[model samples]
Target: MLDRAGYDRYLAAFNARDYDGVADFYVDPPHMEFFGIVITSRQELKDFYAWLHDNVEENVRVLNFAASETCTAIDAIVRITAKKDLTRAALDAKGATGFFPITAGVVQEIRQFIFYTTRGGRIEKVECALPPMALETV
Candidate 1:
């Protein structure tokens, strides 16, 4: 059985770009990275994640979800629910490592993610890999 509730909460914080909440989800700062860019410190990781959320033009909504081996993967469709008109100023003010295009429909995006967890215990680390959007070609 999958711990859907717990997974949902974790993803909620992640989707909201609550870097502090995300950090607290981890126990000892489990390794996290994006295309090989490693994140170690909680503050550094939070800053990195915050930058990502600020840059991105969309948010996620869980469509199909699953969990295995302490990892919770979700296949969800992202909607560009909103776009900041002041994006230019925001970017100029803070900047970002990278940003993504707001897509339509339920594209198959599997959130390959892992969390440090134990029975009746809090997670020690949380990491996720959001691979490039992949939709069925056929």
Candidate 2:
């Protein structure tokens, strides 16, 4: 089970743009889903982040975090600053789009509800949800 501190370290590594360090918190074959894209291998996870970081700087700020024996949940804000222009065509070619419209030199942020399933203190799967309209104002 990953405790608060362990999760904090993972967030630290991620916000620091330390891809390798962030990968250390996951199981060998990580299963991560974000914005409808599924990554089922460590190399894919690395590659995804690498490609994303190449175009923008991303950071997550946790508003709330909770962990139990097998699962962890978080309410977070994802901030992205685009380093280069990413047109819809380009994003579509990559099979995805920015969380919001992104223009070079622009900053965008959004709230996300994320869940993680862990095994042996390592993350095995992750999924994210958007806040419902009812809770968006809160």
Candidate 3:
């Protein structure tokens, strides 16, 4: 089960971009699914988050969250700003920069739903659902 204090700690670690700290909340062989891509290991998740942090600065505002015995769901407004040049290929995968030019340093907002499953007080699975890229400003 996820308590408020535990969730707050996780949020703090994520907001701080502390990959290791965030990983500490997960159990071994943690699984994460984002945009249909599955990450099957804790180390891989940490690495992916590190890469994301390096490429973009992100801020998350939690609109609401609900917790059960084994699962927690969060609704959040996420803002991501490119810190450096994003490759054409990267933008293409996101289905952005095709119709509208999304150059580097552009800020985008996304409404996201994140679901977490916990076991023995450690997160065991995470699934993230996001809408299409809604460029707030480019």
Candidate 4:
């Protein structure tokens, strides 16, 4: 097994919104996650983080996360809770109020499943399965 303590520190840094700390986890080519999009490459990853930090107002606060590194893959189940400051700056440019919500406290308790393919000790790629969406079927 990998050093659980070290891994915990890594995870804690991520939960703390320490982008640089999370950046350190990537060695060779890095993978970037922007909402539902993925971009690979160092410079692209940096740009992705910059945009994410600038535009996304939500924070990923991990309630709990447990990860296991197998011979060829890493599996993790993370419980994440989030709060978003939904701003209307973009909408305001088009003349719209900042106040609109179907209900208060839109916080979501989501279970995220992350699977990673590994080469040597570094993670190569990741696949994620998130909680179901709230939209009704047509």
Candidate 1: regions farther than 4 A off: 78-138
Clashing pairs in 1: 26-124, 26-125, 27-124, 27-125
On lDDT, the candidate that comes out on top is: 2
- What does candidate 1's lDDT look like per residue over 54-132, in tens digits? 5344456676666654555565655443223334344445432233233323222334333343323345444445555
Q: Give a tens-digit lDDT track for model 2, residues 1-138.
A: 888899999999988878899899999889987765678887888888888889998888899999999998999987788899878777767766534547888877778888999998999999988875412211
lDDT of 4 by residue, 27-51 (tens): 5686634235565865655555554
**Model 3 ranges with Cα > 4 A deviation:** 91-102, 131-135
In TM-score terms, candidate 4 sits at: 0.53
Best by TM-score: 2
**How accurate locally, in lDDT, is each candidate?**
0.51, 0.82, 0.77, 0.46
- TM-score (C-alpha, index-matched) for candidate 3: 0.83
Give per-residue CA lDDT, model 3, range 10-33, as digits (tens): 999999988888988998888876
lDDT of 3: 0.77
lDDT-sorted candidate list, best first: 2, 3, 1, 4
